[model samples]
Target: MCKGLATLPATCLKSAKDIKHKISFLLQKPEPQAADQKQMKEKTAAAAAAAAKRVPTAAEVEKWKESFSHVMNSETGRTVFTSFLKSEFSEENIDFWLACEDYKKSTTSKLTTRAKQIYQQYVEADSPNEVNLDAATREETRQNVENACPSCFNEAQKMIYILMEKDSYRRFLNSKLIQDLSQTHSDTAQMKKKKNNCDCTENRQALAGGA
Candidate 1:
C-alpha cells in the first residue's frame, strides 16, 4: 500500500495510480536500434549533401555565363534578371524595358494605346513604376505621349537601358549569386574535361590490351 493511500478517496487513489504508471512509461528509454537508425540517417544525409555539392546543375552553369543580350532574349534570363531587379527594388527598370519592347512590336492601331500606357505608368513623375530618367528624358516622354508614336518612348528606353547596363549590370556581375554561378560553370567545365580525358585513356588502354 502507498503511504498516502489511506488518506485518499477510492477515486483519488485510482487517479494517482494512473499518473504514476504514465510517469514510468514516459521515463522508459528508447530502443537502441532507434538511435542507430537516427545516426545512419544523419550520415546518409551528409553523404547526399556532399554529392550534391560536388555536382552543379547545367542550368546554373549556362545562366551565369550568358551574355547580357542572350539573357535578355530568353525567358529564363528575363526571370533571373527580374529577380535580381526585385532584390535591388528596381524591378520597374525591367518593366519599362519590357513595356518598350512590346510597344515597338504592337500593330499601328494598338501602338498609340500601348505607348500611352507605358508613358503614364513608367514615365510620368511620381508614377508607381516610373523609371529613373533625367528631367529632359521625362519631359520628352511626357510630350511624346500626346503624339504617341511607336518610337515615342525610344529615348527614355535608351536611357533606362544605359542605367541598367551601367548600374544594375555591374552589380549583377559582381553579386555573390552570379559569382557562385560562374564558379559552378567553371567547375562543370573542369569536370567535363576530366571525364573526357578519362574516357580517352580508357579507350587507349583497351586498344593496347586487345593488341
Candidate 2:
C-alpha cells in the first residue's frame, strides 16, 4: 500500500509545488512606480510648505501667556494648572519647567513623577476590566461574579472602580476650572468694553454741552 501510494503521487507532488511557487510569487511585493515616488515627493513638499506657513500671532501668544499666568497664580488656578501639568503637558514641557533656574527641580520632578504614576495606575487598573476573557475557564468565575454583582470581583475590580472614580472626579474639576477661567476672561473683556463705551458717551455729552 505504501509503495502504491508513493508511485501514484508524482502528479500530485508537482501540482503542490506549482501551487506553492505561485503563492510565493503572488506574495512578492511590487516596488513603487516612478509616478508613485513623484506623488509622495509632492505630498512631502506640500506638507512642509503648510507647516512653514503656520506662524503664531503675537495676540495669540499674549492670550496664552495671560491664561497661563492666571492659572499659575490663583489657588483654584494652581490646582487646575497642576492637573493640566499632569494631563496635558508633555514630558518635554515638564522637563523644561524643571530646568527653569527659578523653579525648584525637586518640586517639578515630584509633580511629574506623581502624574505619571497616577496615569500608569489608571491605565493598568482600567485595562484588566476591559479584557475579554470569555475563552478562559478561570476567567469564567470572574465573569460570573461580574454578572452576578460587579462589586464582588475582588481587589482588581475594586482598584479599577476606584481609579475610574478618581479619573472622573479629576475630569470634572478640570472642566469646572476651565469654565471659570473662560467666564473670568469674558467678564474682564465685557467690563473693558463697557468702560470704553461710558467714556465715549461722556465725551460726546461734554462736547454737546460746550457747543
Candidate 3:
C-alpha cells in the first residue's frame, strides 16, 4: 500500500510549495474600484456630519452633568461623554454600558447569541476590547453567561458604570472643552437676547416716527 501511494501519478499529488502558493492566491484581495473609494469617502463625510449634528445643547449638557445616569441614558450625553472618554482612552466604559443596554433588550430567542457576543467582546479575559472587572465579578459573569441569563452582565456593567461615574464624569465636567462650550453657549444666548431687544426697540421707534 505504501509503494502504491508513493507511485501515484505526479498530477495526483500537490507539492508543499504548490499548496502554499494556492493558499496565498486564495487569500489575495481585489483592489477597490474608484467608485468604491468615492463611496467610502462620501460615507465617512456623512458620518462625521451626523456626529457633529448630535452635539448636545447647553441645557442638555448641564442636565447630564447633574447625574451620571442621565448621561448614560441620553444619546446626546453619551456622544459627548464618549468623546471625552475616547480622548483619555477610556471610552470602553461607555461602550460597555451601551452594549449592556442593548444586551438587556435582546429577545429570548436571541439571548444566548447576544450574551455570548457581549461576553467575548467585553468581558472575556485576553480580549482586546475587554472592560475592567474584578476577578470575582468576572468569574460570576462568566458563569451567568453560560446560561444566557438576561442579566448575565449586570454586575460587571454596574462596576463599569460606577467607574465612569466617579472618574470620567468628573473629568468631563471640569475639562477645558466643557468650559469652552459652556462659555460659547452663554455668549450665544446673550447675543440672541440683544438681537431681540434691538428688534423691539426698532419697532417702537418706527411707531413713534409714524405718530
What RMSD does model 3 have? 24.1
Q: Can you write out model 1's per-residue Cα lDDT over 111-199, one digit (the tens) per residue?
A: 67667667767888887677889999899888888887888989999988888877887787676555554554564465556666767
Which portions of model 3 show Cα errors greater than 4 Å? 1-54
Runs in model 1 lying further than 4 Å from the true structure: 1-76, 200-211
Q: Candidate 1 vs candidate 3: which has greater lDDT?
A: 3
RMSD in angstroms, all models? 24.3, 31.2, 24.1
Q: Summing lDDT over every window of 10 consecutive residues in candidate 3, give the lowest-scoring window.
A: 1-10
lDDT of 2 by residue, 10-43 (tens): 5444433443343233222233334423343354
Candidate 1 C-alpha error for residue 34, in Å: 58
Q: Each model's TM-score, in the order given?
A: 0.60, 0.27, 0.70
Can you write out model 3's per-residue Cα lDDT over 1-115, one digit (the tens) per residue? 1223223233222232343233233222233344423343354334333544533577876887789888777755665666677667776676667767766877899788777
How does residue 52 of candidate 3 score in lDDT?
A: 44
Error (Å) of candidate 2 at residue 50 is 38
Clashing residue pairs in candidate 2 (N, C-alpha, C atoms within 3 angstroms):
none
Best by TM-score: 3
* Worst ten in a row by lDDT for model 2: 94-103
